[model samples]
Target: MWTIMMILLISLLIALFEVPYLRKNAMKREMLVFFILLVVATGLGIAESLEANIPNPLDWITFVYKPFSDFILGTVE
Candidate 1:
């Protein structure tokens, strides 16, 4: 899909710009963090592509905030 292509293209461009600096500076910590993030992102992407139901963090945030939002609306109106 075009969306995937665009994401890949942008990621490639970012890596092209950022990777040499990291390599030149011997930024081991930065490279480790980047690889960890890449693995997490790839796992999520595969789960989504497979249509597997996954609990999203946003759901938890909304669950926590819904009561406060309702209370605020009740008080304002």
Candidate 2:
């Protein structure tokens, strides 16, 4: 709870410090991308704090590659 709050507080401070420059300089696309990635990262952090089963990216990669690896090995044998 406290940790999540602190994390949000820190993120808020960072955005407060950085967003104005982006707004003033006409960096709308960069600003949008920044916030989008920030939201994703913050959500993942909160989920991790809650001990949620966040699936690993590597798991998907392994799932996709395992069959290919097995086929290659079978050909080698």
Candidate 3:
């Protein structure tokens, strides 16, 4: 889809501008972090394009906390 293309194109543009700078400065770790973040962003973009059911981290956090919160409220009441 156009969304994927745009995402990739923008990412490519960023690499085009940034990667060489990282290489010029011998920033190996920075380069690795950049690529890792780029790949993660791209994968999330593609998954979103396909409407994959990506689980929300907040939902898990809330699920894990809810019982404890209820217990506290029960004791407080």
RMSD values for the candidates in order, in angstroms, are 4.5, 1.4, 1.8
Instruction: Please identify model 1 stretches exceeding 4 Å from their true place.
Output: 1-21
Residue pairs of candidate 1 with colliding backbone atoms: none
Q: Which candidate order results from sorting by lDDT in descending order?
A: 3, 2, 1
Please report the TM-score between candidate 2 and the true structure.
Answer: 0.87
lDDT by residue for model 3 over 38-58, one digit each (tens)? 999889988999899999999
| Arranged by TM-score, best first | 2, 3, 1
Superposed by TM-score, candidate 1 places the C-alpha of residue 43 at a distance from the truth, in angstroms, of 1.0
Alpha-carbon lDDT, every model:
0.76, 0.91, 0.91
Candidate 3 lDDT at 12 equals 92
Model 3 worst lDDT run, 10 consecutive residues: 19-28
Cα error of candidate 1 at position 38, Å: 0.4
State the lDDT at 8 in candidate 3: 91
Model 3, residue pairs in steric clash? none
Q: List the candidate 2 regions with Cα displacement exceeding 4 Å.
A: 24-26
Residue-wise C-alpha lDDT for candidate 2, range 1-77, written one tens digit per residue: 99899879988988899898989985789999989988898889889989999999999999999999999999999
Candidate 1 structure quality by residue, lDDT tens digits, 1-77 = 56555555666676678778888886799988876776577566666766789998999999999999999999999
